[model samples]
Target: MPPETARLPLAHALALGALHGPAELVPVSSSAHVELIPRLLGWPSAALPADVRKAFAVALHAGTLAGLLVLVPLPSPGFAVVATAPAAAAGLLLEDPIERRLGGVRATAAGLVAGSALLVAADARGATGRGAAEAGPADALWLGAAQALALWPGLSRLGLTVAAARLRGFDRGAAFALGRQAGLPVVAGATGLKAWRLARRGVDPGLRAPFAAGAGAALAATLAAAPLRRVTSVWPPAAERVALAAVALAGLRRSPR
Candidate 1:
């Protein structure tokens, strides 16, 4: 059979292209989408190709960068810089070992289940209060450390950051915002690595594509706000996340290796 095409609807195309950045800033799973969309569409491969995945990451981060710029008009670029330092440091330190050996589907699934449980318990305990608060430099560093856990693929940076924030006594909105702010540069770095890998592989330069994709992702992030607001407003990201993890794990268990 010929390679199947994963056709994108205009909106979804634009959204997927645009939403990478902020969508991830929230407690949603962008990597899960990266892994799931191709499977759902029955495309040539189970996951998107490295090039496409890279493009998607760049696009989403672009949107996120845009959203952050728009949202924070003044006096926080320093905060963004500081917050990302730990994740960047941790990522560089762990890249070889994590990607070479520990990163796998089963591990990702287990991380998902565990992360989901954490979210559920924290939410049920009413740990994430309402509104934002001041996060210390230490908190930012710790949150960055928490984000490194997401390198395993199934672990979500947002989920982990939010969970960490809740544990640190940040109210819900504060934890979410802090997590988003901290994660922005991490995704940007991932996009840059993807670009570097693509360049090393002699792929054509995608200068225009990243911008277009970022815009698309921005739109998606905007649209996603409604559902996310409604869902997260209820707290306990654990319930839905656990259900999703269970389903993904069950499917993995049944799939032919």
Candidate 2:
């Protein structure tokens, strides 16, 4: 197919970009939404080449990272490095295989369900005592492991890290802070790596406009939703994941396999 003809439409790109901000800022899996929303809506973008989809997703993440850099302060340098290392290594080694093997609707949906359960259970049991300033190496390791596990499409980086923080006995505020802090480095690293690869490969001229539009929309949406970072309750997002998962599973069952 001609590159121009194969590119995702501008409107779809903008819509997904807008969705990425809040979805990413919260515990919901932005990647799952990016993958499933177009398919659920029967948008042709869902059928675009995997490379195109992946590139667009990376662009969206780049925008989110930019917004986060403006809105959230970084954690201690040592803690941030420790918390980001495992996921960075995991992304280097396993990203391609995970995308190839588990990027399907079924696996994504399963991840959503599983992640929702973990979030709810962790929140229910977690004590509200420890603060972000008190986070130690053990907490960093736990958060790093959670971030690595989140490489699965539906296991959100924010969600899993928050759950990990909670399980480590951090309060909701601390957990939320830790999740955002831990996630920033990982997102920044991954976005930088993927952006470099995309640049080397050279994006099609025809698709550049859509990519720019999506990234701008994501940045705007993320800035607009900055207040949401203060929200520590995980119930709403957890429920949302379950509902989205159900929609995905139902759609999958009804589609021609």
Candidate 3:
């Protein structure tokens, strides 16, 4: 159930989980962690059964995602939660397809490039006079649509949400807060529903360990959020987005398989 649990060094396990958690929630892609970690650790493919690996990854997301939902300072958590619903629903429906063919190294690299470009563009626009206002339901719906794009492995969920918010006229802080808050319910609802279904089917519930990882990730995300905001403010939002996208894409390309 817990990956090939022959008692991997506890340090390795925790380190892996911790690193992935924070990195996943930022503008970076979580899938990149799943793809990169194994190679970095020289972990064998068989170390975790495929299903276990997937479940663990999802669980980790839940934890960090949940942490953000509960902890982040936002204008309206309720509105944020409401906005994220459609994207979450879309994620639930498309999970299977995303898992099967999200693509390999090449595709991931390409996605990073695309995502970076978008980030740079966002940064270029700058937060100067944007993202200050609260978003409306229509704006939230549009943001949700942007988030759906993040289902792609390399796309940054935060980036998409921010982009959508900006497009709808929210300033930087507001956009970031909106995106961060919106994801809260999606993580909780999906994780709870899946765990429930698994239990109903008589599957071991321990399979949900990644959720813990996600919580750790949420802490990590908080640490990063403020710094990231400051950095983005230094540039035009659109340009910053594009710059980040290129850098991430270059890293993806250079990473060893």
Candidate 3 lDDT by residue in tens digits, 40-91:
4456532555555555555556555554554555536656655677778888
Candidate order by lDDT, decreasing, is: 2, 1, 3
- Per lDDT, the best of the predicted structures is 2
lDDT of each: 0.60, 0.89, 0.58
Q: Tell me, by TM-score, which candidate is best.
A: 2
Cα lDDT, model 2, residue 106: 89
**True-vs-predicted CA distance for residue 162, candidate 1, Å:** 1.2
lDDT (Cα, tens digit) per residue for candidate 1, span 122-193: 645645444554777677776777787777766688888877777877777677677766776776676677
Mind sharing the TM-score for model 1? 0.73
Worst 10 residues of 3 by lDDT: 229-238
Order the candidates by TM-score, highest first.
2, 1, 3
Q: Superposing every Cα of model 2 onto the true structure, what RMSD results?
A: 1.2
- Choose 2 or 3, whichever is better by TM-score: 2
Against the true structure, candidate 2 has what lDDT?
0.89
